[model samples]
Target chain A: MTVSVPHSLDDAVRLLGEHPDAMLLAGGTDAMVEINDGHRRPNAMVIALNRVPDLRSWRHDPVSGTVTIGAGVTYTELMQEPLAELLPALAEASRTVGSPQIRNAGTLGGNLGTCSPAGDGLPVLSALDAEIRIVSSSGERTISVHDLMVGVKQTSLLPGELIAEIDLKVRAGWQGYAKVGVRNAMVIAVASACLAVDSEQRRVSIALGSVGPTVLRCADAEQQLSNAVDWTSGAVSPDAIREFGTLVSAASTPITDHRSTAEYRSHAVGVLGARLARRAFATSEGAAG
Target chain B: MSNQFFTLRVNGADHEIADSWLGESLLDVLRDRAGLMGSKGACTQGECGSCSVMVDDSLVCSCLVMAATAVDQEIVTIEGVAPIGAPSDVQQAFVDAGAVQCGFCTPGLIMAVHDLLDRTSEPTDTEIREELAGNVCRCTGYGRIIEAVQQVAVQRGGAK
Candidate 1:
């Protein structure tokens, strides 16, 4: 077995191009667990990405109102000051991921790499309509978060391609994330939801996790709630919120699992959606997040 | 694939590890190869903080870190927390507060407490609980552990 620690994004991609079968290691939070549990083994080469500087930094485009986060940026960094202020919903999701130790080592790119439906970062990425930047020796290309995740633990990324950065647009109005788990800390989400309101576009976006194979967007629910909100007053009726929750629940195709029942997951997402809708469309200035 | 040879710098000393598996965890190498048994492996997963260590100022579960991938990084284990022969203030506080029960999870808790106090000198009870949530202790019901952290805060002059 061999391990190659590349110091730059170019070198990392080049190495990937040379060894398409090499397993990529970001923070090793998920991969190492699999290795420890005897579920996975490194056959030939392991590409460690933590040393790559380009994959560990983030940048903001003022004109585009977008934040591009490097693939190796840890969740702890995401929950900190500047990035947290820029992406509050992402920050909130980051806080709920694993523990502090896990957060210190886990990366958004790892979340995308695993592409689990229960991943805390997925709902936020989906709700924000984030784009994934992929790189290879040949060149770079972009894909939406929705398109990138094909199914459970599955992705459309071709071999020799590395996730370079995640691009999220900063939108107008409020955005927040919440998840229902068995316990408060270090618990995987049984059902999770993210809500983002773009007042400028007069649109509301909702995404659910752990209730389906992939993070699902509640398009009908979003449209119904968006149209129900009075942009001038920034108020939404309780009836609209209830209907929105029902619509969101109806969108989920959950299965009964040991962690939770499908009925519970579907119901929990509805409650989460309604709560988020209330918070987003609250009439009081300070009440809305 | 064969055993990978690498140098891991731990507690200011570089240890050359040879004939190690590529899938060996940092915790595995620290205990087996380097003979540093201070970091215990309870869950063998990140769910338990028994294998907590500081990798370049970041507290992470050593079991989740690939040993070969940590070659160039500075790794700090429980054995490196104090000076030559004396326990650190945090360790001593754990003893004075009687926070040791079975002593398996003590090392990880000590590392976590050090991290929390270093970041927030005068952390509140809620903050301390939240910060130490990762380090679980089935014994003592965590009352004495919380008391020890409060004691350390006062001893360190962070709290009145």
Candidate 2:
């Protein structure tokens, strides 16, 4: 077997472009499990991206209001960085991933590559309207998180392409994440929600995970809440908020699984969505005050 | 497999190994070749913290780490933390609190606690819980384990 370790992003790009069949290994927290489980029998080649220094660093562009995180950056790094405050939901989700060890080794890019509907990072990325940077042998391109995830265990990633980084547009807003799992730690979610509110723009975004084929946004609920609330005062009518929860419930398409019943998933999403929205609204008010 | 070789500095020692199987996990190499038995191979999955070790000062599951990737990095295992003669403060605290029951999860727990105390000398109960949440224990019910951590925190006046 050929295990290729590229020390630079340029080298990685060239290697990936040259070897389309080689499996990309980042963090290896997930890839190793797959290999051990016999779920994936990699051919003679494996591309190890952890050694690429450029893929492990992050930078913020104040002028563009964007925070670009390297694909190889681990969750533990994110929790201890300044980005924790700006992306509270994502940070919170990262903390609940597996365990301290897993968080320290797992990369955001690996989570996206898995494309699992129950992935904790997906909901928050969707809520934040995050953009993913992709690089192939030729060049780089960017796509919305919502567009990248096509379905359960599926993504828009093509062969010979690698995720370079994830770019998040910093917005003046408050956000929170909550999930219902079988256990307190090291468990997958039955249902989860991420709520982001941009009061200045009179916009709200709700992303629901584990209750559908992919992380889904509650567009109708967002629109209803945005139209009903007074953005300047950060006041959202209670009755309209209740209706927003109802719309979010209607949007879920959960299935009965070993972890939870379909009914429970739907109910949890509705309750958690409403609770998160209220918390985000409160945080915004506190910041404004 | 290629004929390339790399040197790894683990636990204050340098060792050269073939890079052909660089994709192999560090856990396997440490247990099979290095003969460092402190880090256990429990689930072989990242879910269990049994194989927890420090890579360049960051705690990570050894099972998920590639041996080649760990080249030029500093690694700290349970054996490294507690040499043959002396033990770290956290290890002593574990013994004092009666936290070592079955002992299967002791090394991982000690590493987690070590990292926590190093980062936050005075961590609150909530912070301790958050830090230890990642390390699971089936024995002692975690009550005694937590008590042991609190005892250390109190002895050092670390908890505010």
Candidate 3:
């Protein structure tokens, strides 16, 4: 097989334009496993983006309250300081990903590329209401994480297009990620939940993974919690948190797999959602006082 | 299929192989082409850390890295870490703590401990457990491995 190691973002786009069928290789954490398991056939060509420099940079815009992260940034980098300070939920999710070896090789872009409901990063992205920037030799387009992910292991990405960067609305407040699996680590999530409270916008968002075909958002639950709690007060009642968990549990339609039963996954996600929400609320209290 | 020319620098020594398969993993090329038998490929998948190595100073599962993508990258495998003659402190600690039973997972565990001590002079028991979470040993119930890491950490100016 032939491989194109593009050093520049433009070169990567051009290579993908030329060989649209070439498999896109970032960290190869997921793709290599598929190839090794014979679940995916090796393509004739691969567009290796590890050499691309621009895809590894991240920028924070204070005015817009946005953080643009290049698709190539590995989870290891996210776990480090400065970046971790910006996206605590993403950092928490990154820590849950496989082992240190896996985190070193896995990228948020790779997570998007796989588009798996079990992906730990997607729930955080969904909770943050992140926007994805897709680019090609033709042009560029921006889409929300909800619109970009169509289904399990599926995305709306065209053949010649690749994820350029992810734009997150970084807000003041607290966010947390929680996952339940058979093992403590190096295991796929049986159920995952991410909760982010934007005190500035008075918005509370929760996303659940490993419970549906795509990362499921609890918009109704979010609206209820957002309206029910006063962020400035920084205190959320126990009844409110319990109701939020119940609403989130009602929103998700999980499936039974060898790892966990549908009923168990639903219950776990609800517990995780409630736990994270409570932590976020406590963090708000810390910030307020 | 076409083969690519790849260069891997391990332990400050550069090794080049001609006509290496682009699809081959760094683990495969390291053991088969470079004849470095130190890193064991117990799980060709990334589940097991037996094939762990340091690439560009970051610890990674070599089996998950594409051989072509690893060109010009610095790799430190078990062979480079010990070099057959000079065993590192981490290895000595393992021997002292009786951490090696079958010895299949030693290289990965040593790499993990080496990484841990490099970052922290005195690591707590919890920190050591978190660091060595990837490398698994079936023969030893990890009590000895944790002890060996603690012993090494204590020796290395105390691993914080």
Candidate 4:
């Protein structure tokens, strides 16, 4: 076995390019569990990406209203950073992951790479329309989070490619994230929803996780809500919100799992979607009031 | 694994070892080789925070951490967090609050509280709950643990 620690991005790219069969190791929270459970084995080499400095920084691009989060930045860092205001839902989700110990070690990229249906970060990223930055020896490319997740525990990541950062458009709006679990903490999400309302743009986006093959946007529900309510007026009717929730429930295709029943997940999505939407609306009201 | 050698500064002590299994978890090495028994091995899975440790002032489960990844970093186990004779304020608070029911989850809970108080000197009850949510204490039910943290916050005058 080979363990390669590349400190620089160029070196990391070169190493990944050279060892196409290598497994990338970041926050090993997910990877280690898989390895221990005999789900995955390191091929001949393991590329340690933790040492690459550039993959752990966060910066805001004021001109574009975009915030770039390095893939190696841990959930703990996200919770502590001042920029968390831009993505409060993400911060809230981060707070729900594993524990203080898990948050310190688990990176956002690891969550994205795992691509689990119940991944806490996925719904937030989907709701935000976050862009994932991938780098290879040849060059770099960006893909939307929605397009990156292919299925359960899978992604569109190609061989010899590493996610460098996640870019999210910063919006001056209110957002909320909520998840149903067997217990309040450290458990995998039964079903999760993130709601973001771009009040300035007069649009709303809702993302659901653990209720489908991949994190999915509730496009029909969003359209219905957009057409039904004057989001600018800041007064969304309860019946309209309930209709949107029903539409979100229709969009869910959750499976029966040890954590929760499929029916419960579907039901929770609708309730959670409406609750999150109401919370976001309240936050918006608080900001405006 | 490649036989690369690196020095790990754990709990203020530097130890040199061959990095043959660079992909091996720091938790395993700390238990198997380094012989630091402070961090437990309850759930080799990351679910249990029994194996929590501080890496560069951040609390992380050692089981999920790659040993090679911890190279050139500083780590503080439950033993190092408090001095041998005199316990840290958080530890003292845990003892005073009678939070150590089974003592199995105490180390992780203490470390979690340490990190929480370090970052937020005056964390609200909700913030404390959020920070400690990752830590599971099947025995104590977290009542005393929360009380301990709150006691520390009160004593510190909300100083993180």
Interface RMSD of 4: 2.2
Residue runs of model 4 more than 4 Å from their true location after superposition: A282-289, B18-20, B158-160
Q: Is candidate 1 or candidate 4 better by TM-score?
A: 1
lDDT (Cα) of model 1: 0.92
- Write down the lDDT that model 2 would get: 0.83
User: Model 4 misses residue A74 by how many Å?
Assistant: 1.8
Poorest 10 consecutive residues by lDDT, candidate 1 chain A:
A280-289
The global C-alpha lDDT for each of the candidates, from Candidate 1 onward, is 0.92, 0.83, 0.87, 0.85
Give me the candidate number with maximum DockQ.
Answer: 1
Question: Looking at model 2 chain A, which ten-residue stretch has the lowest summed lDDT?
Answer: A280-289
CAPRI-style class, candidate 1: medium
**What lDDT is obtained when candidate 4 is compared to the true structure?**
0.85
Clashing residue pairs, backbone N/CA/C < 3 A, model 1: A1-B1, A1-B2
Residue A161, model 4: lDDT of: 94
Per-residue lDDT for B42-140 in model 4, tens only? Answer: 887888788888888778888888787687788888878877889999999989999998899888888888888888888888888888876778898
TM-scores, one per candidate: 0.97, 0.93, 0.95, 0.92
Residue A65, candidate 4: C-alpha displacement in angstroms: 1.4
Candidate 3 local Cα displacement, residue A244, angstroms: 1.3
* TM-score (chain B only), all candidates: 0.95, 0.89, 0.92, 0.91
Question: Distance from true position, residue A161, model 4, in Å?
Answer: 0.6
> Of the candidates numbered 2 and 4, which has the greater lDDT value?
4
Interface RMSD of each: 2.2, 2.4, 2.3, 2.2
Candidate numbers sorted by lDDT from highest down: 1, 3, 4, 2
